[model samples]
Target: MICKAKAQWIGYPPGSDTSKAWRTGDVVIGGAAPQNAKLTVTGNIVQTSNNNYFNTARLYMQSPGAIPANGQTYATFAGNTFWNNDSAKWQIANSDLTHFGMMRFSATGINFYTQTAATSAQWLTETDLASMLALTMQRGGNVGIGVPVSQAKLHVGGNGSPIDTIAQLSANMVIQASTGGRTTDRGAQLEFVLPSYSNGTNFWGQGRIITVAGDNIHGNAVGKMIIGTRRKFNKLGTGSDWYYGDDIVIDGKGNIGIGTLTPSKKFTMAYSGTQLNSTTPITSEMVVQASTATRSVDTGVALEFVLPANTDGTNLYGHARIFAQAANNTNGNAAGKLVLGTRRKYDKIGAGSLWYYGDDITIDETGNVGIGTLKPTGKLAVNGILLAKQVKVSQSAANWPDYVFTPGYQLPSLDSVAQYISENKHLPEMPDAKEVETNGQDVGKVQQLMLKKMEEMTLYMIDMQKRIDRLENENRELKAKSNNQH
Candidate 1:
């Protein structure tokens, strides 16, 4: 029951102001058909609109009932309410009559609908409706850019995405000091600044992760990253006066250093003690440990030291390694060993990842040390012949050969020793030739046997001297008696 209001002006009287020229019709506020616009009478205003450029509807809600959640606390909160009209679109205009925002989706004017996803898993990396987000800005709470809910102070979520274009893929944050010159601060940084307790105006940085350009050579410029953690210091005039001792620096050469400005190697750590003495403990500590009680080859820890090799621009040749691994790979039984390895002679890091090495030394679980071997049988085992300047063998007083001179000790007669040697072809209480060939002789016990034999030989020599003296005296007396008789 709606129609376009077309009342013809009959005529103005000569002296009167105006006159009403109304035919049989109901007053329509919009164009021809208002039902197609989905017009409804909500309040005092006769809201009428049709799909046309000029026809429009405006709702002015000035009471508390208009808000979606009148008691919209955090606990029992219903979300946003959309004021949707089924006509062409919505265009909220100022007094100047310009559209405030753009409309997306199937709508034409300003709409509350959007296409941006709230998570990085959706791969919605594009920036449509990025500026004006339909966010609840009622309280200054945690904000999440691409997450379902804010779990942190600032939660930025996005993972590996295809980066085919410059601004198309990947969720990234850029902090730029674009207007400044290429000084020490080439780019911007994220700093943890703490307010000073002295006054609210003063602030100091507890830590900062900053980026800098190595040079201003445009195309050939290198970049370095610096992560600084300030040490505890007394409050001074300004932050420039504070001393920060620890900084992790990653240079353009891909070298990293902790507590050192210059990193000469791939990774370096430094600790500068004020004054070091004999009692100073080993510093610049690094520990590699297995997380669980189970120990195996897969769960072992190793520190490899390697140098770059002459290969296809990217190869490292292992020089040496210090590792701790399971001594035996048995399932139920477990033991640990510390192994040191040197690079095998044939490997040059040519093609395959060569992890095999020569086990130069090992300290096993039974306190046995092996050199040039893995399994040591004794307290100290060496696969090769050991070369040394001198060797000292120590024994208890009970083992010393001075017992040969004791009163109760019996010395073997020479005739008996000769008889035994003729029968056995070896000394008594000594190993045979076959035994010596199979199992090596103990140097300490052999030395003791040699000393005992030498002492027995000395005693035999002394007894023979006494016998010669008696025979010489008897011969001299007989010669004197024969001469006197003549």
Candidate 2:
């Protein structure tokens, strides 16, 4: 509801007389010049006859020889209907009308009816007539019937038409309508309507439309599709964000992401105790070798057949291949398992053709052991103890025998050696019989005395022999000296 007007009035086109017209009403008042335009009414100006023709009521024009300039023209009055019935009537043609018919106060309560007198009259608002004649006046506009209604809607036609309903406006227009007024049409209604497209021009409005058409439908819309330029995030809508394809989301920073950040997807290192990992593939011929430190499975650890218990039978068979190399530097370490296809008596057991060399024997931390086909060179040290086993010495290519006792062979038991001596009525084979003989008298006193005496006599005999040798050497030296003197 904004209206603007310049205060000062200016002259119109020259020679096009700026004179005004008159109006007919209760008490006709006129002006002083041709441009005089002031009309007022104190009573109703009504029809004196039942005549529907536009009535005419002549009001006196401006007085002659009066300069209409510098006159503040206006009209003011009020009254009820003034009528004239009978043949004798008073009618004046109201042409060259000017000035709005002003009514005021108690006399302004004027109504027009039943005119058998005044034939023609024109009652127009001041601005209303000014709008029709294109006059330079303030706040004047034409009047018309609004759509779907018959109320006189005043409008500045051709210049400023009256804007009443919301349907008459376009986009980006500001409209103020009555909040709850009941009219056939009130608020704005935006719709897309077009007939069949006959040309490229028909598809476009004021500019070219940039859109993505899929499945014969307008699906995605972009802002400006500049030709030959790469497509960016060139579209915007009601919201600040944009939607990508399904599941891919764009955030405020325009960074498109697929998955969450916390507790991210990653690979992990796994550990095992006595067995392989649960996710490891367990095969039929495969085995996992466990290690205490590092929790690793060495290739050396494997399965072997445990000897069955069935009395003292010497025949058994468990044949398999050894696949791992023996431990390096360390003397007794199990490389892998060994399989004996058959067994024999203890005496009959000899070296076989097959051999797996290491320190050639395996002794575990607990002194449990296995000797491969190749015999070890010296005594096997197991858990800080020396293991005594028979050694086979090759005399020739075809002559090799198992071990026989020597000077330092510790008997398995003293009773076993005693039994051997008692049964044979002789000592077991000894490499040093004199050394054993020297030990005969160490158990009892009689033997100890005899041993003492014998030891003394042996010592004396050794000293006597040494003296004899010395005398002979001395005599030889004397004989040589005598010969030299002779």
Candidate 3:
């Protein structure tokens, strides 16, 4: 019914006052108030509709609060429950019903949906909502994004991507001052604060700081990165400073420095540690270990240093690799062989790689060392000539030449020695040139043989001296007899 009341109009059932009405089919009021007018309702209103009803609004609740200000309107359902008695779904739609959203309430949970197309819609539950985007404070009060079990105060799940989890980005990932201001000391920084304890002793801690910046100190603009450490206290009177004047530095050219910032090589490490003050002193500070227990065919470990192939704009020069490898070659019957050598890529495009002459130094499983070869048959084998300052050969007492001076020793006569040398062109007990050419001479045995020859020559000289003494005495007596006859 339409109401055109000047002040107010009260309606009621028949034979009943407006305050107490009992007979009611529906009490509907419809009116259009002028501008700046208010229509207030203090009772409840329910709109019932049929199932699958489309393009209908069950309620158009609006509230335009105070004038001369931007206002908001919302519907409030206070102290009321919505129970869908049947399985009939209640949906809210636009006037044409082409795009709509739905909400369903059941004993299990509430489901919210949004139509994706004309006939398809995506539904979401509480678990789906949590997985889609998470903003959680865990049991330990750690806040996180996309991480339910946070391990830090502010954790972000990395999602197994290349970029960092939490990144501050612009053209690049940067933490800088605001564009509106010019601040000389504005840069990204990560600080570590250590805990303090009350005790008679003081404790110092160490931390690392890394920085990346553009540098043009060498007249070329390039990126320079440095990693340094800070110590809270040290031997220099308990004051903190950057350690070792920048512990590590990497330049645009890819040169790295450990202790010296001005690195001369591709990788340089300078040691400035304490000097030795004990009986056992350290001569070297660096060690590279390549260890393995079980070795098979084509399986080994090595410490290799490789140099890239050098080129002069067009043609390739060479590449060098130096490695110390411990290998067990089942095919070659070599087990536990240690080889230290260098290989070079100096062949032509179609040829194979090459190694410099006399470059390999190998020690076999039996401790026999070989130079310029992989397999060694003796204690020391060298394929090339060897130069040394001096050589010493040790012999046992039984193998020495002192037995040549004994009384029972047999000495060959000069005529026998001459006949043997004339026929064989060598000594009786010594090797010939052809034999020496094939098998190298044994230094200790050769020295002993030479000593025996010297001792036999001394015996021959003593026998000749005795015969000369008798001839001289007879000549003196014959001269005395001739003088007495005269």
Question: Highest TM-score among the candidates is held by which one?
Answer: 1
TM-score against truth, every candidate: 0.47, 0.14, 0.41
| Model 2 score (lDDT) | 0.33
lDDT of each residue in 347-438, candidate 3, tens digit only:
32325667442237878788899987777778998877889999888899998989978888888999999999999998878878888788
RMSD of each: 14.2, 36.0, 14.5
Query: Whole-model Cα lDDT per candidate?
Result: 0.60, 0.33, 0.55
Q: Per-residue lDDT tens digits of candidate 1, residues 1-486?
A: 332234222333467655534344233344444322223232344667686874687554222332223342111111222222322233222232222322333222122323343422211122544533332111246555444345666655555456454443244555766725565455667888987666776788878888777567655446678887676552232455565443788887989988675789999987644443433342325567666576575456779888877667558787798888887778865567988887764433434555567778989989799998778877778878999999999988998889888877788888999999999999887888898777767888999888888877787887789989999999999999999999
lDDT of 2 by residue, 1-486 (tens): 111122122333455656423323222324223223333333454534344673754333222333223542222112221111211112121232222222111232221112122433444333333322321211222233111111233322233335543344432333343424323212222223343356534532222212111112233211111111112222331344322211222222333333211112231112223343353344323355545432222334444444543468544433333333333434444333322223332222345554222223454333345455232323332223434585343333222111112244333344675797787665444323565455432223343334444544455576679999999999999999999999
Q: Which 10 successive residues of model 2 have the least lDDT summed?
A: 221-230
In every candidate, how many clashes are there? 0, 27, 0
Give the number of the best model, judged by lDDT. 1
What number of backbone clashes does candidate 3 have, counting pairs of residues 3 or more apart or in separate chains? 0
Q: Report how far off residue 470 is in candidate 2 (Å).
A: 2.6
